[model samples]
Target: MRDYPLENRGAFPPHVAAGAGASISLAPVKGGFVIHLLGDAKSDEAALKKALAKIAPELGADVRKSAPNQWFWVGDADVSSDRLTEIQAGLPSQFALADQTHGRVRMRLSGPSSRTVLAKGTMVDLSADLFAIGQSAMTQIGHIGAMITRIEDDSFELIVLRSFAGSLWDELNHMAAEFR
Candidate 1:
């Protein structure tokens, strides 16, 4: 993997994933962190709620549903790093941690053109009112695990696994090329 430091002054690396599909790298958002977790029918929602409620005051946790069985808790500026131990302590054993280093891929797309290109294949209504800033949802773009978020008025970010990264990138690039 090519290293692009946060301080680097250039466009992000074109293809960020090592596996088969197209991928782009999204710069880490300034203060927040994305913690991926998995829960089953047997999983404890009460514990999950208790954990989040405990940390909410400090981190400002917001739960965003990505898929039927997956979810992400976004912690705010003061809340993320400060309470890692407490957060982990609160989580059940089944929850898997997916942050930058361990995840298959992390890519961000934000621009006026983001939505236009995305609309070509995505069925989800990405209108501003429905998917406001910081709101995240997990749905399929074709067959991939497309976790899309409206980062700004015109920009959106999609995160998929490394194996499918290339295909996703190619799909978006092909769709966006016409716009250019």
Candidate 2:
């Protein structure tokens, strides 16, 4: 009998260097968790957020709005199954939780020219004033569906399906070539 062993790997390369002193850079944000939270029709963002804070005070996850009653809770630490179960059990009866850590991948596109590079693929206005820090938008980048979050004045995080990560990474790299 033949045995097959599978190794864990990231969706794309660890890091892509734009160039020397490049004005734009792209990198995969691995080893973290992505949890999808859905609130009942009666629950509002404020109520959900308040409830979430009580249930997972130490999780330190960034709650990014995906829709009116939906949000993606993301963090840079890996969560154990026991901990996940605890969170689920603590949730209010009006909310549902689904772990999407493996199904979704995150990418960080940063630097002075990051917005300019992203503009080539997305229609969302990347202007600082319009898309201020901490704001998130679920939009299309080229043909891939992604959630773009402004994490800083010159940095953005893009969350995409694991399968589409490579294509999106390539497209972003191409768009940033001029600045490299």
Candidate 3:
């Protein structure tokens, strides 16, 4: 897939907040990156986890298995692009890795109202009772393919393909306006 890299304007409107007994916020997380470890994770999960522990331990924290052979490693902006290159080269030969860093738009949504706004279009049941913290799923938001991960009790990182980020942000903000 072609990459659509975007410049961080740093002047977008606030996306996270609390008001009227409802709370939520959206913030641009700088340097959000991802690596698609698209391979046999089920067979090599233990070994892959071991290698990651020695190299980049943060990867093991939220490794989402969207399918039997498809896994995506979520990484924060703190992880440098150069480091991503290094890790890709160091992986075992059985693995097929792709640098999806520039392919996604990463946004953090937090607050009690955040889930409500997201649930409007999400297909999965997002009840905290079902999707607790640290859990993630590949689903659609605003009919756009998205990966939602509850990184905190009331916070989630919604990573969408770059092309859909802006529209998704607008849809999310529109839904959030009710609580704002």
Candidate 4:
């Protein structure tokens, strides 16, 4: 398996990395950065709560459960400035990111056709009744490791592991192109 190093285009559009089995686009969203909290037995909820409280006043963020098991304390992009430091300081343990070697990939999919495109590969009923705006989930359509999140009424973002990014993108692009 060949490896393609990620492009370092700080604060711009994501760098696209493509290889034999997968493709990834790491887009940087302004003002917000994802802090990967531990998901294993070592996860400390008390410390995470404390950290969230400390940053709440500074960033005015709203804490929401990301998936069935994951919690995310998100604020606007401005939260990146001071709130991140506050969260780090408040937590009893340091935040660690996911290992890149595991093929975890993220992308920002938005615009008018985002939802329509994702529907091609996803079976999880992307309709408004099931997956409404601001909702996120972890699931799989076929062999794809899907992290589907709704950005708006017409836009959605899909994150998958590097091994499946190309397949996911191709499916989405094919569906989305029809809308253009």
Candidate 5:
């Protein structure tokens, strides 16, 4: 019999390069948690939000709407199994939770040129007046599907499938090259 050991690795290299003068910085948001929440037809956004706040107040996770009655609860800390179970059990009967911590990868793209780089690939209006802070759009960057959320005026967080993270990262680097 053979025994195998597993190791955790990030989607990008340890020291990923950024554009010249850091005009556009890109880095993997490793070691965090991504929880997908789905609500039934009878469950509305307001009800789900209220229930989640009452149930998992300690999580401090940023909630991003991915679709109607669907949201992704993201945080910068890894959640424990016991905590996850508690959250799952606390959800209302109309809501369900799926742990996507290991299934998805998050990347932070910031600096003044972040929007310019993203505009090259996605059609979402990155204008401040249109897509204000906390606004999230599930769209495609090049050929990769991702959730782009404006975390700040010059910063965006991208959540993509783990398998496609590397591809998306490479594409972002290329898109940001002209700024270098």
Candidate 6:
């Protein structure tokens, strides 16, 4: 597992912006906050959403609600740790949270054929009618557990475990090349 290092300086590289058809690249969200709600309070969606509303505008467009009890706050890596600390303070005692700053990596794919590229490895239907922009789901792409977010009309972001980033990227990049 001697893959290249994480881009500690910024969110990720923008090289893929130049690729043809569907471009594949690491999303520039170096680290983000992953909220893990626990206990009975976890089911209080309104309270949780309200609490996060304080910072929702700050996170801007990167805020992702991947699941019922899972919310990801995406922002600059340097500010994420402090931001998570502030957020946890507002959480109820029944809830738990952690900063998955180094455990995850986001892969971005965009263009007309982008969904088709990911469909080769993911069982989740990436059709726009079902998974529209601003929606996200926690699912598996091949053997990798990923949080897939449809960022735009033809753009999707795949958040995967860092341990499988290399292998997963290899698999996706291989399929995406055909669209080039």
Q: What's the TM-score of every candidate structure?
A: 0.60, 0.92, 0.80, 0.55, 0.90, 0.75
Which candidate ranks first by lDDT, i.e. highest?
A: 2
Alpha carbon lDDT of residue 99, candidate 3?
69
For model 4, the superposed segments whose C-alpha errors exceed 4 Å read 1-32, 39-53, 56-68, 72-86, 92-105, 111-113, 162-167
Top candidate when judged by TM-score against the true structure: 2
List lDDT for all candidates, in order. Answer: 0.59, 0.86, 0.73, 0.52, 0.85, 0.64
Candidate 4 structure quality by residue, lDDT tens digits, 49-153? 666666566553333344433554444443332434555556555443222322444556665555555666677788888888877777775567776777677
> What tens digits encode model 2's per-residue C-alpha lDDT throughout 1-180?
102222347999556466778898888887878999988778777776777788887777479999988999999877776778788898888888888887899999999999998898899998988999989999999999999999999999999999999999888988988988
Sorting all predicted structures by TM-score, with the top scorer first, yields: 2, 5, 3, 6, 1, 4
Tens digit of per-residue lDDT, candidate 3, span 18-91: 56466777776667557777765345766776776777775553566666766777766455556666776777
Model 3: what TM-score? 0.80
TM-score of 1: 0.60
Residue-by-residue lDDT tens digits, candidate 6, 1-180: 112343564333333544443344434454443443443534565666666666444653355665655566555434445555676676666656655656777767777778887888888887889889878888888888888888888888877777777777777767877766
TM-score of 4: 0.55
For all candidates, the clash counts are: 7, 0, 7, 1, 0, 2
lDDT of 5 at 134: 92
Two-way lDDT contest, 2 vs 6, winner: 2
Candidate number that wins on TM-score, 1 or 5: 5
Judged by whole-model lDDT over C-alpha atoms, candidate 5 comes out at: 0.85
> What is the RMSD of candidate 4?
8.5
Q: Candidate 1 — worst ten consecutive residues by lDDT sum?
A: 1-10
Candidates ranked, most accurate by lDDT first: 2, 5, 3, 6, 1, 4
Taking the tens digit of each residue's C-alpha lDDT, what string does model 1 give over 77-113? 4333335556666666766545432233445665556
What residue runs in model 6 are displaced by over 4 Å at the alpha carbon? 1-42, 55-57, 60-68, 80-82
Candidate 5 residue-wise lDDT, 61-117, digit = tens: 478999888899898876776777788888788878888877898999999999999
